[model samples]
Structure formats: C-alpha cells, structure tokens
Target: MSATREDVGGTPLPPGWAQPAHQPDAFEISTTTFEQRATETMARPFARRAIANATDHAAALTTARFVGIDHDALRDKARQIRAHAIANLPDYLDQWIDAAEAHGTIVHYAADESEARRIVAQICRDEAVTRVVKSKSMASEEVSLNSALEAIGIDIYETDLGEFVVQAMGDRPGHVIAPILHRTKDEVHALFSTMAGRELPNEAEALTAFARDRLRHAFLTADAGISGGNFLIAETGEVLLVTNEGNGRLTTALPKIHIALVGIEKIVPRRRDLAVLLPLLTGHGTGQQITTYVTMVAGPRREQEPDGPERMHVVLLDAGRSALLGGEFEEALHCIRCGACQNVCPVYRQVGGHAYGWVYGGPIGAVLTPLFRGQVEGGELAHATTLCGACDDVCPVKIPLHDLLLGLRRRRDEEGCVPRSEQLAFALWGQVWSRPLLYRASTAVARGSLRVIARDGVLSAKAPLLRRWTAGRDLVVGRRRS
Candidate 1:
C-alpha cells in the first residue's frame, strides 16, 4: 500500500506512515451478497419509502434550482477545473504544503487507511486529547477514525444532527449527504427518547433542541475538533468546509486543537476555482444555492485572533486514491463527493447505501468500491447497476459513471474474479449466438418451453432454471386478456 511519494502525498509530521492502525474485521465488505443485503433493506418498508421520497425530492429540487442557468455550461466548467486540478495534483500539493506550513499549519501525509488512522490517533495521544468534538467527515468514516480514537480511550462526539444519530445507533451512514436518509423520524424519536430516559416529543424541532443541548457541552469541554475538507485551496493554503449546520464552524473554532483528514484528490489549484465549483456542488448535493455555513481556514488561531483552535493539523490521505492517477480510472478522482449520482440512481434508491457495503454508495460507489477495495471483495458491486446513464447525466463534475462501471466489470473478467458458473453460462451463450442456426433454434425451443410453462399468459410460479430471476419479476408470454 506504499504510495508513490513523488506525486501522491506530502511529507510526514513524525513517526512517518509506518504505524499499524487497527483494522476492523470485514470493515466495509458485507457479510452477505448484494442481493441478500438489498432484500433485507427492501423488507423494511419504512426505510424504503423514506429513501425513495427523499431522493426523488432532491432530484426534483436539483432540476428546479438550475432551471434559469446554463446548467450544462456550469457542469462543463466544473469538470474542466476538477480535471485540471487532478492532472496537476502534485504541483498544487507542493505549493499548498509550503503555503500551509508558512501559515503555521502542521501537515501530515498518510499513504493508506491504516496510516491515516495511526496518524490522527497519534496526534490525539501526543496532544493528550481527552474529549473531541467532530463535524461530518466522510474521510474519517473511510479510515474508521472514530473507532481508532476510541481504542485509545478518547471520547468523540459527532455534532451533526444526522451523524450524531448514526454514531449513537452504531450504524454506518446510509447516504453521502444525508447520513440518515434511510431512517424515519419515528425511529429517531424512539432512540432519542431512550437516551433521554423520559419520552421526548416526536417533533423534529424538539428532537433537534435535545441534540443541540447535549452537543453544546461537548463543544465547550472538548480538547480537539476533527473535520473533513470539502475543498483545499492550493493558492492560499486554506481548507474549505461547507455545511448547512454551524457544527463545522463550532467544531473547528471551539476546540483547542483541530485536525482535518482530507483526501489528496480534494485539492483545487486556486481559491478562485471555488467560484466555478461551489455552486455546482451545492446545487447538485442539496439543491440549495449555497450551504448555510462556509468555513475556510488557512491556519490555526493567530496571536491576534480572538477565536479558533490553537493548533491546526491537516492529514493529507492517499488511501488508494493516487493509484488511479495517470491510469484509465483517473477520472474518478474528479468527483466532488456531491452524491448527485446516488440521488438519481435507481439501484441506490431501491437498496440505499448500506447494501453497497462501503463508506460510499450509488454509481460512484460501484466504481470506487472495486477500485479502492479489491475486486475479490467488491467486484460484484460493478454488476449492481442496470448500465443506465442517469448517473452520468446528473454528475456535477461529469464523471462518466457508466463507462467507469463497465471498465470495472471488464477488469473483473480479465482478472478472473467472476464466478466460474457465470463464465460458463456466458461462454455457452456466446458459442450458440455465434452460429445463426443454433441461435434461432435455441430461441425457438426457449419460447416453446416458456409457452408451456405459461399459465394465464404469465409464468406465475418459480421454475427450476429461472427461479431467482423470476422471484421479483413476472415473465409474460402471450398478449394479456385485458
């Protein structure tokens, strides 16, 4: 997992990229198949309806928000900016490192997940940090940073309304933007009630106040704050964090020490690039013109400053990202973590994020899971989609999701990761299809067999060969009586 240092990362702070951080057993890989997981989620009608309604509404808002503008032109410009930043990533990182260090930010580099965990944990220990307040950070989830901090006997509180619920329930995030998209308000009410010892009101506003009251103590007493960066400005050496909640600002400003675990691919060449990138990010992610709180920090609190953390550290994490650079899959690096593709993906809407069995999900997840995790563990995810181009259409950075997914499928085959049974079936189909006579004969025989099995123009019962395929879908043979 050693990264190519020349291009992939910055210099380390200390105890350089070598400590073995604890890895959770079967961290993101599901114990069951995608079908099994999807079935389980589907069985929960509340969760299914919650996810569907939320996504459809978000997709609608996204369409409506961009109605008066040249949305395609904005997406194209954003794509170009992201493409340029990624293409010249190393140079931008070098400039950022120099500028950040000058601004009094201590920058650390982690080549992979284990190192990322080790780096942040070591920082906490070194600072003698006891309690920590945190904002939403997908990178932290990717490396399982909270688990690492807990292992060292530090108390960590998730301040974001949704993420706090996820942490309290010991559940993985269900969506990239809305971590609790699959959870209903009733479910949250129940959990909060149990926590309160007295039944709390089932209203959203009351529940929010309860969470705020509890988290305020954490903010005041915490020694450290941790967050993920939305964008890294290379020219000014600033970490840009956008959120609808004030937690991001509070998390960074209130704590004595602040640490940010940001992916290296998140870097942009200049602060001006945000003019092109931020609107697309906000519009596509939440369908808002802009996030409520936009915090940009170039360094820790200065001597003259009245607020902010005393010391700031930025951990530039590679974690399997640099491997994709200069390769066929590099375009994936251009993603802004908007989760727009997820909102429009039919498969994601059906099963939600958990079924993908990873930190990320939806069309981007299908491509990234196989690439970040190995094909042996995540290859099946590539086949989880219907090859629909809806994700491509909705992507803010214009990631060719369909092509990336297809590439993974092709790679899986080339690497012999696919099951032998499927290989044989496809091989047999290819052989027969190559011969026109055999193809015609096979189709005729299949049609004749189906007609016999058909009852009232439908194959109503599960048959031996097609049982799995027909379980949720109906196979209609002749014209309907109606």
Candidate 2:
C-alpha cells in the first residue's frame, strides 16, 4: 500500500473501495455524513425525550434569569471586554505570569497537547503520584490527559459525578455540563453495579451517594489534583473554577499539588471583569444566578495559610488558539464554555453532542473544531448547524456562531475540501439560476420529473436527487414557481 493508503483511518472500507489520495479517510468521511447519524439519534425515543426536557428546562430558566435585566447590553459589554482582552492578550499574559510567579504559583506554557500532557506526567512523576483526582476540564479532554497519565501508571479519578459516570462506562462525554444525559438510569445502574460488584438500585440519590463515597477517598488520598480554569484573572493572578458540584472545590483544595490546565483565552485583563462574566456564565449555563461552588486559587498555599496545595501549577495551553488571534473567528476565544449555544441549538437537541465527533460540540464546536483540527478533519462539522442564529442569541459573550460557521464553509470550499461532485452541483445550480431561460427550462424539467415520481399527489423518495428531501415526508410539487 502507498503511504496515503496506509494512512487511511480505522473505519473498515467496503470491498473494492478506492479513495483519492487527497480525499479524507473513512473516519473523516463518516463525520461529514452527520445527517445519517442525526437520523439515527432522532429515532431514539429516550434520546429525544431526555434532550427535549433538558433544553426546555435550561431555556426556560435562562430566560427567567434575564427578566428585568438588559441582557443585550450585558452581551455588548461582554463583547467589548473580550475584544479588548483578545487584542491585548500578550501583555495580559505576561502580567499574569509575573503576578502568578510573585504569588508563588508555578506557571508553564504548553505549545501543544503533547507538551501539556508531558507537563502533567512530569508533575505526577515528581510527586510520586499514584492517584490523582480531576475536576471537569475540557482542556484535559482535548489533550487526552487521563490516558497519558494512565500509561505511566498514575491512577486518575474523575471527581465530577457526570465525568465519573462517563469515565466508568468507558465513554466520551455526550454534553459539556451533562455528560451522561443520554444515558438511562438503568444503564448507569448496570455500570455502577459492575464496579461495586453487586446489583445497585436504579435511583438518582442512590447513584450519587455511591459516586460520592468513591470520590471522597480519591480527593483526600490523591497526590495531586488536575483541573481546568474557568477564568484566569491577570491582575490578581487567580484561577477561577465555577461548578455546580463540590468536587471542584475539594479537588483543588485538598491535594498536595494542584495542576490547572487552562487555555490562554481564559485570561481576562482584570479581577473586576469576573463580576460581569460570572452571572452570565452561570445564568446562561445552568439557569442559575450563581453556581453551587465558585472557587479561586491565587497560588499555592503559603506558610501562613492553613489548607491548600503545597505547589500550584497552571499549564497555559495554546493548542492552536494563538493562530486564531486577529482572524475571522477570533471571537470564538471569547467563549466561556457556558454551553448556551448547544442548549439552544435545534440540531444539537436532535443529534446530541457526540455527532460532532470532538471535545467541543454545537455551534462552538462547528467553528472551533474545524479551525483547531484543520479544515480537512473538522470541516464537516460546519454543516451540522441549521444557521438558525439561536446560538447567537443565547451566547453571553455574543460570539457570532452562525457567521463563523458560514466562514468555515467558505474556507472548506476555498481549500477544495468540499467534494468535487458538490462543487460541480453548486456550479451548475448557479449557472441555471443566473439565466432566466435556463432557470425556467430546469424548473419545467423538475416539474415533469416530479410528476413522474408523484403518486397520490406526493413525490416518491425513489426520485434521483430528491431522496434526502423526500425520505421522511411527502412533498407536493407546486404548479407555480415564484
């Protein structure tokens, strides 16, 4: 096999399949077929019910939180604050580093995932870490940090309940805030039973208590704690963690070494900026005025301090963020990981987060994944949205998600990542629509073709070029073309 052939993804190819050298492998091709997966996901009654309930409750609560408040003005201010931060990110980063160092925090810069993981592994080795507890951090997921540490014999425990459930089940997170939302109670009971070596009750309280018991030990005994920073304040050199669970507090406070893996964009210029961001993050994220826990670790515990980490480390991960600065989608950096976009997204509620096939999901995923992972690998995600602008309205930081998705599509076409057939089809469409005579001729042909396919005044799905459209519903051809 040639190099390109050997480089093809793990997805099994059909007999006699021959992909072009430039074409993405079967895995990438499969992601582009999100429509097919979406159909499968939407067919599940449980998934539909669970997602509908979650999004509905979230939407209602978030809307209620904004009552009597000028939500738009807050969004505008958020945009202004983020734009200024992005423009002056370098200066803020340096100031943040100097202040953090002064506060006795050890800060490390990782240019890529490998470096970030290496930093964590080295910290584990230095500490002789046998067990580690983790708070929810998507940055850790981006780097596959758990597996990296596991390879070196470090036992990493996910302390967050949702995270722990997904980890125990050997699955990836389905949603940012609610990882196991798609899972049924029975499925969770079965998973926990396997771990407990007994049959467990399929009840929420029971499962939570079981998990808390398991995590409590991990928190106290852990040699180190790994977390993701929600916001990094440059002025105070503090790393903020916002969570609805107590695990975030315990994981950072109890451990001898606390390692925070954060993206550079998480930095805000001043401490006061958080006053504006916290309410927006919590209100839009979980429909609460404030989360259950909001913890800030300025640095390692000092000799004067009674309880905290002996050493503190912040791994500022680039992972393709620096390149986005001053680019078309630079506003994506403003995301607070609030997950509001996914909650309001029509497509996400149907297909769920897994269909996006990345750490991030929904509108933000459609924009960031493609940019960070490259147009060839993540470009297909751009088509996952309906361009409904619901994501825009719900975004606290006011990132233009729909516009960014369009930009990704344009980038795909410009990079020739779009399939040749699709390009040809659109080219022909443009030619036909641009000319009146050709347009009329094409419509006449289509009408005649539809008539042939029509039965009882509804078109059959067997019609070529109309199968996808007619798959789930009947389409009646209109006599008049406007």
Candidate 3:
C-alpha cells in the first residue's frame, strides 16, 4: 500500500453516498458458521489457548464498580459527544485543520490506504529519514504504514511492548489493546531471545528490559515519530495518546518530527470529553484508575521548549469511514477502541481475532470490516458473531453492536454473498413451509429421520451439515408428531 499526501479539500459526499448493500439470503445460516469454521481451521492452537487463559472469564463477570458514578449518564454524554462530532464532522475537521496549522503542525488527508502510505513515504523521503519510532496507532495499522515504510528500507520500531513483540514475530495484532495476548510466556521468551540476539529470561520485566534497551537507542537516533491518535480535539488541535506504557510519550517527544495518523471520526468537540473517557477506558479495560501515561500533544516543541519534536504532522485518514457517518452503521464510529466489546464477545472469546481474517474483531469487527472493505471481502465477517448482547452492554459509547451484526448479515444475504448450500437449504425449508400439506408431511419425515439417527433418545449421528451442532453436545429430537 502507498500513502497519498494531499490537503483535505473537496465537497463531502451526499449523506448516505454508498448505502451498505443488503442481502436477505445470507442470514439463513446460523450466526456461528464463520467462527465454527475458523476454530477448526486455525493453525495455532497454542495462541488460542493463550488468549483464553489471559482473559479471566470469572474476573470479567465481576460487577463493574460504578461507585456513585452514573454509567448511563457517562454513556449518554459520550454518545452525544461522538454523535455531535460526526454530525458536524466537516466543520470540526476544518476547525482541527486551522488549529493544527496555527500550532505549526501540517495536516494531510488521504482518501485511501495507498494514498496514505504514499504520503508518509514521501514525507520520509523528503526528510531523508532512515529510522523511525512508532507508538500504538490503529490508523497506521489501517493504512499498513509499517510495511510501506519498511519497503522503503526505513527502520520503524513499534515502541509499545505488545506492538514490539508482534512486530518482531511478523504477526498482526490479535487484540487491539493487547497485541501479544495470543502468545504465551514461552513464545514471548523465544521471540525476544531471537530478536535480542541472545537468551533472555521468560520473566515480564526481563523481556521489557530487553525491548527498552533496544528501543532507547532507536528513540535517540530516529528522525521521526509516528503515532495513532486516541482522540483528536478540534477545539485545540491537540491529539490524545493513551497508553499503559511510557513509550508513546518518548516516541512523540524524542524524534525531530512527530506525525500522528488519525481517523477523521476520532475527533471530539472539546478536551473535557477526555475526563469521562479516560477513566472509563481504564476502569473497563485493565481495571485501573488510569493508565501509566496519557499524553496530550498539540504540536511540536516551540522555540522556547528545551526538549520536544521540531515539527509535527497530523494525517487524517477517511478510508471508507466518512461514508458510514450518517448511515445505519453510523453508531459504529462511536467506538473508543476500549476493547470492552471484544472482551465480552462470545464469538471473540471462542475463536479470537485471526478467525475473523481481519484486523478489527468481535462485534466491532463484524460491523466495520464489511463497511470498510465492502460486502464481498468483509461481508462474510458478519457471520462470526453469535448475536449475543454482551458487546453492546459493555460498550462505553452504547453502539448497538448486535443489531448491526444482524443488519450486516441481512445485507450480505440480499447481495447473494451467502454460500450455495445455505441458500438451497433455506429455500427448501421455505418451500415446505409455504404448503401446509407438505409442511406436515415433511415434519413426519423429519420425525422418521430423527428416529433413524437417534440412539437411546439422543441423535448422535455425525450427519454432514449437522456435525457441528452435535460435535460436543447431545441433541434430543422431539418425538411428538406435531
């Protein structure tokens, strides 16, 4: 992918420019089809096991400590803030543009991934930069920025510990918050030893020290720093970087040039919004009052500052997101990347992120992949969820994730994206139900078929399509003729 370096200028698309396609036929299969298939096909059983072990199910079930804080009120406020920002996106974008410019930061807008990568590469070329340090930024991931930079022979180091581990292993992050959540201690020890060119202890502190020693050198020598913005404040042109690790601060401050890659929807109207969001994120995520670091950078170091970057750049990427702003999927933009949805997601809990075959996973991934990549490439992702309401309930912004998953399934079906076997099965069932006599006769036949398959009152036959349902559980067929 190449990045583009263009100014943000153009008429916004008409509201609902590309309505998400609807495919009613795709919903015939149960929502578990994709996840079930993924579980059987995934190559890394150790990774899946690691993820299951890391996320404590019983701990997640413990009641969140609201403690005089009104979760409902906070959610309402957050929703309003996101809704307002999206509604006036163009205006706030302009405000952000002006303020960033006023603060001596150059802002670039890219319409797609290639364009975005080209722009970043060009910036690196212009600066004659050979090395860069990066903070955790999903926008950079979205644009595949690291690969693009590496293609140009630029050494880019991911500073976040989890990101660093995944980068060293040449694996995409499995979880947004914990990129290395899928790897066990032994795997991490192996990866670290390989990367460090020596054996390192399997302890977390030792692994961290190894990464820190390696990255500290890069920080001092890097020509530029690249980061993903958690929240972009339109009122001040300030970008918020939230992290449990201190690397975000170091990367942004040490480099000569600091470039932030942010999606347009990340903008909030004011800084005060951070008050509610930061605590909520910490509490819901790792059960902390605050992360180790929360840096709000407005621009590069000024003439008076003793230590900071000399230049700053903010790239606003609108790769298929603006198109989703006012449509049925608009609520998706309200996502805070808290991973709460993923944490509680039954599908995600089972098969994990790679199974979705996309970057974003769980409820959010189901909604986003299809919308961002269009129905054909990403539409199949909708079938990964179990329509469980857990994701929606834990969402800090109150996005209706379950309903959106169902809607996407409906859209995919209408678009004829469903499998042929599924279509045939549902069609045959529909035909049978449409005729009362045939429906009764089919019921009778089904009963007879059940009797043939049943053993000791339980149907344990390993039928082709029904094998998945019966694999680990007993299914008892009703004997009543009705």
Candidate 4:
C-alpha cells in the first residue's frame, strides 16, 4: 500500500508489522529529571555504545565533508539567512500565505497544539479519509499527530524505513536524522522476523528489503499523506523538503490529499536561500553534499502534470514559537534542524535524545524544550548540558547554543522552577563565596574533608554531599595522597 521507495532511494514491511507495540515512544519526554533518566540510559551499555559510535562517525563525516569547501563562510551566510527570516517572520508568512493561496494551496493557522490537531483531523474527516501514509515529520511528532489520527480511527502508517520501524516498535526517534541510532541491527532483525513469522537474514540490506515490500503496498492504498516542511519559500509559495530516502516524494505525490505541518520558523523569504541552506542542512545532518531527493510543492497538480496530489494543505503552527520572536531566545528559531549539534554534544552522545524528555534532544533541544514547552515540563533539561561549546562550533546556522542553554537556566532560576533546595544552596553559596574569610575557610575545610574521603586523589562514588556528581564521574583532585 506504499510508494516504490524500494526501487528509488530506499531498500525498504505488513499486518503483523502493524501489531500493537509494547515499547514506549523512544522520543517521549520522561517524567524524571535529566539525572534520573540519564542514569538509566548510562546503565544500558549497548544503547550507549550504539549512540556514541553513530554520533562520532556522523560528526567526523561532517568535518570531512567541509574539508575543501569554505565551510565557515557557508555557515555564516546560513546564519544570516536564518536570522533575517526570523526577524521578518510576520511579513514573510503573510507573503507566503498570499502566494500559496494564489497558487491554489489551502493554508490553516494553528494557535497551539490543540488547534493544529483539530485542523488536521477535521481535514481528514471532511475528506472522508480512513487510511493515511506519512513521511518522517518532526513537526508532526512535535504536535503528536499520529496518535490523534489513530484516536479518530484512521489507520496511519509511518512510511520512512526508520520511522516505519519506530512505528511498528512504538519507539520515538532517537536522533534527528538517524531515528534508531540507539538500536542495533540485531534488534531490527528480531522485530522483522517476529513480524514475518520466519527467520529473516541478519543483515541491513535484507532487513530494508523486507520493510520496503510491506510499505510499498501502503503507499498505493493510503487516502492521504502527512509530512513536514524543511523550509518554506515565501516568494514561490513552495514547501521545500529534502530527503535521502525517496519516501518524502511519494508520500506527498501519490496521495490524493497531502498535509504539511510546518513550524512558522521554517519559512524563508526566497527559494534561492536554499542554495546556501540546503548544503549545510544535508552536510551537517548526514555529511552528504546534498540529499538525494529534493521536492518542492507549490500546490496541487494541474491537468498537464502526470502525478501529484489533488489537494494540498499547509498548517502553520505557532505553539509558543511567536512568543520568542522578540525575546532573548529568538536566535533558537534560527536552527536548521541539521542535528549536527546533537552529534557533537557530549550530553546527547552519552544519553541520546530520550533523556531530554521532549521531542528534541541535545543542546538545541535543551534550549527549545524550555522555550517551547516552558519550565514546568522542560526547564530542568537546561542543566542536561555541560555548557560545552561543542554544539556552538558545529551548528551550521551558528546559533549560540551554549549561551541559549545558560539563558534557559537563568530563566528557570528566575522563575522559581528550580527546586527550593537548589535555590537555597545557591544562596548559601553566594553568601560563602562573596566573603574572603568565609570562602578561604570553607574551601580549606572542604578540601581537607574531600582529601580524607578520596582514594588516590579520586573521590569515591559515595562521596558525602557530592554523591550525585561523583557517581557518574571521577573527580581527580590532585596527585598527592591524603
């Protein structure tokens, strides 16, 4: 029931594949703080190893891809383009809407998550759609669109190979581009074999071929398609999408009705901007010179066109994005979703995306989670980083991730989202450190106590009052023994 991605860009699944999944969403936000969840992830040696290996390899490739190119200048231009777009988001959005409507595409506005969900569900209901096929769309995940459609009795299939695996297994994406970064090929083999009711080959290509077989059927039968926009060109009224696997093209083209849920921040004033942004997006995201399939949809197909959707819909979701327009965190809007920052981030490398407990993870996730979801649900994530500037250096758009993370932390502390104990401890710290005698005396006492508790100058995991920090790290104080 799916498109022919198997022959195109993917080596690509069945009813048994659609069976209920037992695992929670891999991307679902955890109720626990970063410390609690990170500890659990750290305990999973296999998952940690997989995550570290994938990120390091991707990070290295990204570095290699930019070797001969003027990577710095490209990144600077991209940053400028993104910054300018966010600055004039309103003007560009209005222009885009006018242009899109003139080109016969329908546009809908969503003030928040509830409205976006309602709009899409209503469209499916109005169109009498019962089955839907979807491409990988982070924006859809941001609004939890799949569950919403399923709740209304519409059968939804995630058509991209990784997303299809995620859907069948009921897991969320672990990394932005590589969704199953924390999973092993063996895990995929087991799942596919269980679905097939026979032993499948224990290989990547074989596994992909099986999935593609199942999904190709879904592509032809689905009544509608749902996708996310990587960038919206205001001048041409086209939603631009870039993908390595060809599913994005089929998902939007083969279906009679297509819906794109795009964050307002994804808009740009001109199509030419892609000339600068697309390379950085692909290079930083997967270390490719460019994505294999780049699709631009302006509206529905006309009589002359061989194949395309009969109707097109674009949902512009605000959902707290506009509030940051003129704020300190506005620069966070400049992100191109390259996932480069996540690849180089020490925190994300160790814990993966799930520990951030939101749709996104890593340094950008830490900033966006609190800004988009607010402090109550995501404030603690700001501390999930080491304030390391690795993400800042890697970001294709040049977003100041380190500063934005610090800003989120400051906002959390200012809003009393921080625990009372933490607040009190900081207050006491300020009091002690602000005085010369108190600071000297306190440091001396603390050093002596730590020296007594340490073994060979490395503090034990059971170190009093510092257990949390020491438990996951070795605090090497000095070479001298107590």
| Highest-scoring model, lDDT | 1
Cα error, residue 462 of model 1, in Å, equals 6.9
Compared with the true structure, what per-residue lDDT tens digits does model 3 show for residues 1-482? Answer: 22111110122223321121332122122234464546653446776666666555422532355556787898888888888888899999999889989989889989987888988998889877778889998778777788788778777778888887777666667787878877777887986675555688889899888778767877877889999998889999898898888889988899899888899999888889888877776766676778889999988898878899888888889998889877888888888887777777767766777566556777898888889878876788887777879888888788899889999999999999989999999999999899999999997887888777777778774644467667645788785843
TM-scores for all predictions: 0.91, 0.88, 0.85, 0.91
User: Per-residue lDDT of 403-446 in model 4, one digit per residue for the tens?
Assistant: 99888888888897877898899899999999999999998888
Per-residue alpha-carbon lDDT of model 2 for 1-482, expressed as tens digits? 11221122222223222212233221222354567666766667798779878888888899999999999999888888888898899999998999899999999989998899999899888877877889999999888888788778766778889888777666667778888877888888876675665777889899888878777867767889999999989998899998888888887789899999999999898888877898999998889999999998889988877798999999999989999999898999989898889889988987887777778878998888888888776888898888999999889999999899999988888888878999899999999999999999998898888877777667766656777777645687776545
Off by over 4 Å in 2: 1-40, 437-482
* Alpha-carbon shift of residue 227 in model 2 (angstroms): 0.4
Please give, for residues 166-281, the per-residue lDDT of candidate 1 as tens digits. 88777788999999999888988987776666788999999998888777877887889999999999999999999998999998999899999999999999888899899999
Q: What stretches of model 4 exceed 4 Å from their correct place?
A: 1-29, 434-467, 473-477
Candidates 2 and 3 compared by lDDT, better number:
2
* Model 3 regions lying over 4 Å from their true place: 1-37, 40-45, 57-63, 431-482
Order of quality (TM-score): 4, 1, 2, 3
Model 2, residue 229: distance off in Å is 0.4
- Cα displacement (angstroms), candidate 2, residue 228, comes to 0.3
Model 3 TM-score relative to the real fold: 0.85
